[model samples]
Target: MTQNQTHDPSGLSQEQAKVELLQLQAQLIAADQAYHQDDTPILSDADYDAAKRRYQALVTAFPRLQEIATQLDTVGAPVGSGFGKIQHVVPMLSLGNAFDDGDVADFDRSIRSYLGLDANQPLAYTAEPKIDGLSLSLRYEKGVLIQAATRGDGATGENVTANARTIADIPQQLQGAPEVLEVRGEVYMSHEDFAALNARYMERGGKTFANPRNAAAGSLRQLDAEITRERPLRFFAYSWGDLSAPLGNTQSEAIERLHELGFQTNPLTQSCASVAEMIAHYRHIEAQRATLGYDIDGVVYKVDALALQARLGFRSTTPRWAIAHKFPAELAWTHLEAIDIQVGRTGALSPVARLTPVTVGGVVVSNATLHNEDYIRGRDNKGEEIRDGKDIRVGDWVQIYRAGDVIPKVADVDLTKRTGEDVPFDFPETCPECGSPAVREEGDAVRRCTGGIICPAQAIEKLKHFVSRKAFDIEGLGAKQLEMFYGDPDLPIRTPVDIYTLEERDAGQLAKLKNRSGWGDQSAANLFAAITEKRNIALGRMIFALGIRHVGEVAAKDLALHFGSWDELAKALDLARPAALAHRSADMAEDQERAEANREGRRAKIKETREAVLSRLELHLAAREAWEDLVGIDGIGATVGLSLSDALANAQERAVFDDLVGHLNISAPAAPTQESPVAGLTVVFTGKLEKMTRDEAKARAEALGAKVSGSVSKKTDILVAGPGAGSKEKKAQDLGIRILDEDGWLAEIAPK
Candidate 1:
C-alpha cells in the first residue's frame, strides 16, 4: 500500500469499525452525488481517494464488515432524473487507482502472477492519458449513430443523444464501423475554450463553472441541445464498450482502429513492453500535461493482448486488466503578500492569503485559502503542531497547491525564506465590513461576524446565495446583478422580501429599470415575470434561500419534509426556541463547571446562576415536544436543530422570515410519487444489516416512499434489527414499534 493508503495503527473493535465505515460510506456517497449528479464536488480528488483508501483498509482489516462495504463496489452515482435512462450493453466499470510507483509495480506483479508468468517474461501494455471529463458512450448501428448516453452508475446512464449530436467531434456516421458498436470516450473542453466560456458567462452576468471538466459536464447534460451546441465541447474516443465483433487482437491495435474509423483518439497513446516503459511514458505525459490544452488527471494502463485481458477478467467495480495511475497534486512556492478576511454568507470570517502571482497546475493563482486562524497558527483543531508549528506571517514564502485542480490552498510555509521583518498575522476581533463584534463560538473553528444583515459583505453574499442555482435560481438575478442592485440606492434589494416587492416598488419610482444601462424594456419586464413565477415556491427551496447557517439544501429538505408546510415549520421552530436555548445554556454551564472544577465555591455559584436562568426560561410541554420533534428528524441532530430554532427565535431574523413569507405563496413538501407497502412509514435500521449496506438500505427505503430515520422513536412504524442489535432494539420494543429481522424486513418491502 502507498503512504496515502496507510491504515491506522491502533486497532478498532468491530462496532467501532462499523461506525467509522458507515460514516465514510455516507461521506463518499454524498461526494459522488455532488460530483456526478449535482455537478458540484465538495471534496478534492486526493482527499476523496484518501478517504476511500481508509475505508477499504478498514474493511480489509475486518473481513466480517465486508458485506456492508457495498459502496466500494458501486461505480458511479445513480442515473439523474432529468433525462431518459439507458442501460449500457456493457457496464462502464471504473478503474482501480494506483497513486505511486510501488502501486504500479504491485499491479504489474499481480497481473503477472495471475497469468502464471515469470517476472522477466515480456508483457505488453497500452498506456494513455486518463482524461478528466464526462464519460460518454456512443452507440452506432450499421455505420450510423444511434444513441449516446452518460456513464451513470455503470449499468444505467442518462440518454443525451440530442446533445451528443451537437458536439462537432462526435461523428454522425462511421463508414467502417461494425453492425453494433458502442464507442466509449470522454467529452472535454480545452483550457482556452473553458477560459473563453467563463469570460463570456461573466460578461453576461451568469454563473461560471469551477473548471473545464465541470464546464464540459454541465454543458453536455443541458436539457436543451442548443445550449450544448453553443458550448465548445470536444470528444476523444479511447475505448469500446459493446462491439458486434472484435476490433483488434491488442489494445493498441483497437485504439488505432478507433482512430481509423474517423473517431478522434488521443495521439499520445503508446504501447509499453514493460512496467519500466509504462512508468517512463507516464512521466512523459505528466511533463506535457500543462501544454496538452485539456485536463488529464492521470494515465491509464491496460493489458495489450485481448486474450490476456479476457483471462484477467474483472473485479466487482473495476477491470483486473487495467489500472489508473493518478497524478500527485501540483505545488508551487510563492511569497505571501498579505492575509485578508472575507465574510461569507454565513458571516464566517475566512482568512485568505494574497500571494505574489504564481502558476500552479497551469493556473495562475494570486490568492489561496488559509482555512482558519488555527491553520495560520500551524495548529490543528486538537492544538497539535502541524507544518513544524511554523505560523504563517506576512512576507513569508508559502507553498501553494490547487487541491483537485479546483481550490487554491496554502500547503506549507517556508520558514527559512521568511524575512526578519515578517510579523505574525493577527485575526480581527470585529467584523471588518460592519465593525460588529466577531466572536468564535465554543468548538467552532471560524470566528463569525455578529452584524447579521447589518454587515454589508454578509448581506450581499447572502443575497447572492439566495439567488444561486440551488436556491431560487432567478434567471435575470445572478450574483453580478444582485451586487449591482444591492449598491444601487434606487433599486436596492436588501433582503429576500425586497426581491418580491421589487416590481411593485419599481413601478412607483421615477428611475425606472427600463431606463437603466443594461436594462431594456423587454429585459426589465422579463425580470419581473421571472420573479413572479417564483412567487409560489417549494418549501425546501424557500428554506434554503433564507440562507440560515448550518441549514444547507439537504437539511432544508429534511426540515421541509418533516414539517410539510411553512406554517407548521414556523410554528414548530418558534416553540422549539426556548428548549433549544435551555440546551445551549446547559452546555455552557457544563463548560463553566469544567473550568471552575478546582474552585468549588465559584463552580457552585455558576451552577446556581445557570439553574436560575434555566428555571426562569422554563420550556412548556409543547416547547419541549417541539424541540424533540425537530431534532428527531433523520440527519437533523441537535446542532442543525439548534441552528434552525435559533434562526426563527431571534426577533430581528424572525422579522425577515415573516416579511419574506408574507409576499410569497410557499407550497408544502411534495408527497412521494410512488406508493408501496412501506410508503409513509418511518423505518429505522439497527445493528448489522447483513442483507445490504446501511446506505443501500436507506436509499431502498426512501425510493419506496418510506421515511428512514437514524433513531427509533414513537413515530417509527417499523424497526429492522439484525445481529447484535442493542439499545435501538430495546428502545423500539419499549416504544411498542413493529420489529423485523433482515429477511423479514426485506420480505415486507419486497416488490409485491
Candidate 2:
C-alpha cells in the first residue's frame, strides 16, 4: 500500500502521469468491454489489477489526473446498443475476488470483524462453483417467466427473454413460486455441446467460437431466439435478485425452496460452518472443475444467512459478504501471422487475427478477433491509444489469455521483438467476397458491405432473418434447412419469395423432397403446411422480416402503428426516398459550400441547393409528407429515416421486398378497442403497475383500441394513474385529462 518506493512507469513528471492515467483508464475500460460486452478477455485479472494499482498510484502521485479518477467511479461502460436496456429494481452486484487462502482468510476475518464477532465464533458460508457463463436474471410473476435480462452492468442489463425461453433448462411456469420472484443464474454450454457446435460451424465454414463461454453468450444474445434454440444452452439457478415475498429464512433454505418449486438449484452448493470447511469445499470444487463437462472459473462463498448478508451490506461494485476465490488466469504467448477480414451476413467486415497455433488453457488457438479497425490501429474503441501506442503488426509476439474459458484475445504486443519487416495490417476498403464498397458510417464501430442482395452472404443472412422466430416463424423452415436449400441448384429458396414457391417446384433432380435424403413425405408436407400457415402474418412481422437496415422489432412496430397497413407503409417508403435524397443532397452541398467559404474567408451562395429544391418539385404532397412522417416517429431519428428511405429506393431491395409482399397478406393493425369507450383514444400510464407490469398494461390498452403514449399531452384522452404517479398525473390534471386509478382503468375495459 506504501508508494514511497514507486517507480514512475510514465517517467517522473505530472504531464507524464496524466498521460499514464489516461492510458490506464483506457486499458481498464477496454478490458471491461472485452470481458463483459464481447464475452472475450485479453488481460488476466492479476495483470488488470496490477495496471489499476499503477494507475491509482500515478493519480495519487499527481494532482492533475482527478478527471480520470472521476471516470473510475463508473465500474463498467454503458450497455451496448444491440439490445433493449433494462434498469434493475435491485442492482445486480459483482463479487470481490480472492486468489488464495490468505485472501479467503482476510475475507472471512473482515466479515467477522464487521459483525464484532470473536475469533472462535462460527461464520457460516455457502460455497458453490462459479459457472463460467452468461449471468441471467429471470423474473417470474404469477408462476410465469415474464422477462429475462443479462447482467450488462451492475445497475442495468439487456433484455433476453425471447432467447431465454428457448432453453429447455428454463422453466416456463413455476407451480410453487411466489407471486413475484426473480431467479438469477448462469447460462452455460456443456463442453460436449460446445465441441459439437464448433464442429458444425467448421463444417458450414461459419463462425467457430474461441471457447464455450463465448459460444454461450453469443448464442443467448442472438436477435433471433430460433438461433438460440438450436444451440445447446443450459441454465443453473444459483441466486435471486428481486422478489415480492420471502422464500425462506436463510440463503440455504431459499435455494432449497427454489429446488422444491420446480427450479434447478446447484446440487454442490453446501453450507460450511467454518472457514476451514469453506476452504475444503472450494478445493473440492476446484478439483472437480475439469471433469464437470462445463466451464467454471472459480468458487463463490457467501454468507449463508440472508439477514447476515443484509447486515454486512455492499460496496460500490461488489457485495461485502461474498467473495469469489478465482483460479489463476490461463495465458500463453503466440505469433501474429496475419489479419484477415471476414464479411458477416449483415455485411459487417470483422477483422480476425491469424495466429501461429499456440496451446492455451488446454486448447490450441490459431485465431482471434482484432475486434475492429480501431483496435488494430493501436487504439481502444473510444479512440484512446492502447498497447502503449504500439499497434499490432504481423510477426509480432503477442501475449494471449483464455479468460473464463472464453475467447483467446491478444493482451499485449512485444514491440522489442518486432522486426522492420513487421508491418501494420491494412483493413480492406472493399468486401473480399463480393468486391463491393465496404463503408463505415459515422458513429458506427463496424464497416459493412453495401452490395445488398447481390452479396451472397447478405442474401442468405436476410433469408435467415426473414424466417426468424419474430418474423415468419415457419415451423419446419430453420436456418440449416434454408442454408441447404439456398445452395442447392435444384431448390429455389434464395429469397423470401422463393420460399413461398417451394411446394410448387420439384424437390430435387433425384425425385420429390420426400424421397430425398433427410426428407420424408410427412416432413415435406409439414414444411409446406407451416409456410402456408404464416401466409396471413402481422404487419409488424412483415416489416421486420424485410430486414431493412436500422429497422428492428420496435421500429417495425412504430412504422406499423404510424402507417396502419402494408399498403400505406410501402407507399410511405416509396415516396419518402426521393424527398430524403433531395434533402441529403441539399444539406451536403450547403455543408461543402460553408466549409469552402470558411477556408477561403469568403461567402458564396451554393447554386446547387436551389437546383435540388427545384428538382424536387415533382416530389408532390405524398413524398413531402412521407419524409416528414418517417422522421416524426418517436424513436426514428434522421439517420434511421435516411437508411429506411434509401433501402426502399434501392432497385434490388425494392424488387425483393415487392416480391415477398406479393405472396403474403399483412393483417391490418388491430383497430383501437372498439368495444371499450376509450377506443382510438391516446392513453398515458404513469408510476408502477401492481397487478401487472408496465409492458402488460400498455399491451392491454393497445389491444383495446387505445394508443398508448409515454407522456400526458393535450392529445391524451385517458391517464391510468398507479401508485407513486407524480409529474404525469399532475400534467393530466392540468390538461383536464381523464385520470383513473389502476382498478378504475381495469373496470373501464372490463365486460359489462
Candidate 3:
C-alpha cells in the first residue's frame, strides 16, 4: 500500500517487465473486444485500469517496456463471423472523466480563461446526460452507415458493424442527405430491462448482473450477433468524430439535425445561454435522475457554437470546448434516532431506521431501510447479532447510501459516535401500530405482527395499493389525498368503499372535510369523482388492487389474460382451496405420525403436540373457506393466494373489504380489442428497440392481438430481436421460434 520501490507484484526484473508490458498491451487490445466491443466484461474497470496503468508505469519507469507498435493505435476490424469489418474513417476516442462538479466547473473556467473571452461574450452551452455504456463511432457515407467501431483507445476501436446495425435507434441511413458523417454515441440498457434481466437470471439459478453497464457490455460482446440483437440496448448520440461539412453552425443545431435524421437524442439535452444556465440544467437532471428510465453518470456540457469549439479545441484526453459536470455519488450521514418495525402485507417484519433529515442525491432523506433485524445490530464473534456490543440503539449515527443512485439504505453505523448512555436495542415483541403479538416464521429474519387487517399502517398501505397506478389508477386518489380523506376529523371515510360513496356522504360533513383549512372542496370532489370513475376496474387491475404479495403489474396482467374472466378465475380458485386444505391436513397428519414415531419420550412429544395444536388453531383462523377458495384459483400462485386469502378472511380485513366493495364496484374489465398482430400467440421482446418504444410496442401488440409474455417460454411464436437483445433472444433461438428485426417487424404489421 505504501509508495514503493518496485511496486510491481509480478516481481519481474527490468528485462522481463518490458516483455510482460508488451504482452499486457496485446492482451488489453484483445480484451477491449470483450469489454467495449462485446457485452461481456473480461475484467472489471478497476482490474483493467490497474493492468493498463501498470503497463504504462512500467513503460515510463523503464522506456524499454515500450515495445513494437501492435496496431493498437489503429481501430481493429470486427471479429464476429456474422458481421463484416469496416475500418473507421476517423479515430474514436475516450474522454477523461472528472469525478466531481467542481472539477468540471474548473475545466469549463479553464477553457474560458484560456480563450481570454470577456464575460459579455454570448457563450452558449449544450448539456446532456453522460450514459454509462459502450462508446461507438458510427460512420455514414452517402447517408447510409458504412461502418461502426468502438472507442478502443484514443486512436482506434474494434469494428462492430453488424452488431451496431442491430441497434434500432441507430439509423442505417441518415436523412437530410449529409454527404459524409461520423456520429458518436453510447449504447445502454433501460432500468426496467436491466431489472427484468437480472430477475430472470436469478430465477434461472444464474448470477445477477452487478450493474446495467456491465449487463450491456456483456450483451453486446457475445459471439452471436443474434444474442446482441435481443438485449434492450439503446443509443443516444452526443458528439461526432468525422464530418465532411458541419451539420449546423451550433452544437444544438447539430443535435437537432441528428434528431431529424432518425437518431434518438436525449430529450433532456438543452442549449443554455450562460454557465449559470448550464449548471442549473445539470442540477435539474441530477435531481430527477433516479426516476429516469436509463442510467446517466453525469451531464456533459459542450460549447454550443461550432466556430468557438473549433478555436478552443483538443486536450490530451478531452475536448477543450466541452466538460462533463458530474453529480457527486449520493451519500448521507444521519443520526439513527430509532429503528421502527413494519409488518409487510405478507407478514414479514421490516426494520426501518428513523433518521435526522439529510439531503442526498437532491432528495431529502429522513429514513433509511435496515433490511433486517440482523443488519440493524452488528455481528458478534460467531457472526450473529451482538448481545454485548451495541445494537442499532436509539440515537446512533448511520451512514446511508443509494446504490446505483436509488433507494436510501443504511450502509453502516458509526459505533464510535454512540454515547455510553445508549442501551442495547431490543426489537419490538408486538406490532407498534395495532398491538398484535409479532410472530417470526422459521427461516425468516424479521418478526411479523399477527394483527393482519386491524393494523392502521397495513390499512394505509392497502389503500395506497388499491389506488396504485397499475390498480384502480384513480389519478386524484393518490397517497396524500387518501391520507387526507382518512385522517380528516370532519369526514369519517375509513374504507376503500368509502372512497366510491364520498359524494353520497352528508353535505355539511363533506363541506367541512373539503374546506378544512388546507384543501378545497373542488380538489376533494375531484378525488371522489376520480375514484368513482375507476369502479369498473379490469380483472388484472382488480387482482392488483387486492394487494397480493409478489403480484406486480406484469404478473397481475398475466393472470388476468390467462384466466380471462373474474368469475371463472374465482370459481377455479374456490375449487383449489379444499385441495390445499387436504394437503395441509396431510402435512399435519404426517407431523403427528413423525412426532409419535420419533418422540424423545413423552415430554418431547407433549411439547410437539402442544405446538402442533397451536399451529392448527392459527391456520384454522387464518385460512377460511373463502380464503382457501381464492388461493385455489389456477392463475393465483400459492404465495399470492395465501396472502390475499389470509388478508380478506381476517375479520377486520373482511369488514374493510366488505364496506369498500359495498360502496363501489371493483369488477370492471375492458372489452377485448379486434384482431391484431400477435393475437393468440405469446411473444417476448428483448433488447434495444428502434421502430417503437417498448411500451408503445407492447401496447400496439396487445391492441392488435398479441399476448406479450415477460419470460421466454415454449408457447412463444415470434421473437423480435433488437441490438443488445441478450439472453431472451438466445433462449428463443434455442427454442426455434421465428425471429424478426425492427424492419421485419414493421413489415409484418404494415398495411397490406
Model 2, 1-752: lDDT tens per residue? 01111233233345334433544544565566575546566554333443444454454455334322322333333455678988878877666666567667877988876777778987788999888787889999999998998876557888899999999999999997889999998899999999999999999999798788778978988888899999999999888888989988788999898888877777889999988898899889888988999988788899988998887776545677887776765778999988887666568777777899997764567876566777788775457776677788888999876543224567688888977887788889898878999998654567889887778878877787788655787876866687788777777578898888887774543245445448776777778899999999999779877877656566677678767887787787787877788777777777787778778887775656746763655677667766766765544656567877887777877887888788988887676535777676767788877775665577677667776765655657888989999998997899798999999988988977
How would you encode candidate 1's per-residue C-alpha lDDT over 1-752 as one tens digit per residue? 12342223123445445445544554565566576546566653434544564555556456544534535555566666689999998998777667678778988988886777779999999999998888999999999999999987688999999999999999999997799999999999999999999999999999987778778888988999999999999999989999999999999999999998999999999999998999999999999998999999889999999999987776556788998887886789999888988777678787778999987764567877676788789876568776788898999888886533224566677777865887888999999999999998776667889999989998997787687555787877876678778888887888888998888888644235546647766777888999998888899889888877666566777778777788899898887788888988877877777668646544343454655666677669788777766777776777777777878877888999998889888888766686689877888899987656675677778778787777776778999999999999998899899999999988997877
The order of the candidates by lDDT, greatest first, is 1, 2, 3
> Clashes in model 2: which pairs?
672-705, 673-704, 673-705
Instruction: Please give the range of 10 consecutive residues that has the lowest summed lDDT in model 3.
Output: 1-10
The reply for model 2, stretches above 4 Å from the true place, is: 1-332, 356-366, 380-384, 401-408, 440-445, 507-523, 582-625, 668-752
Per-residue lDDT of candidate 3, residues 1-752 (tens digit): 11121233233345334333434543454455575445455453423433444444444345322222122122222234343444555555334334344455565666666566556766788888888677778889999998887765546465777788888888898767578889988888899999998998899998877778777866766667797887778898877877888889999999888888888899999988876777788889989988998877778888889998876655323456775554554567888887776655445566677889887643456766555555556642234543233457778787776422223565556788877898877877788878888886543454778766567676666777677544676776666666676677656456676676677774756556444535566765676677677876777777667665555454566567755765555554554454445444554666676677667455333334434553555545333434433433323445555444444445675566556555555444444566455565666678867656665576667666666755665557878889999888998889898888878887876756
Model 3 CA deviation exceeding 4 Å by range: 1-334, 342-349, 356-366, 379-390, 488-490, 514-525, 582-636, 648-752
lDDT of 2 at 7: 33
What's the lDDT for residue 468 in model 1? 59
Model 3 scores what on Cα lDDT?
0.63
- Can you give the TM-score per candidate against the true fold? 0.68, 0.54, 0.46
User: lDDT of each structure?
Assistant: 0.78, 0.73, 0.63
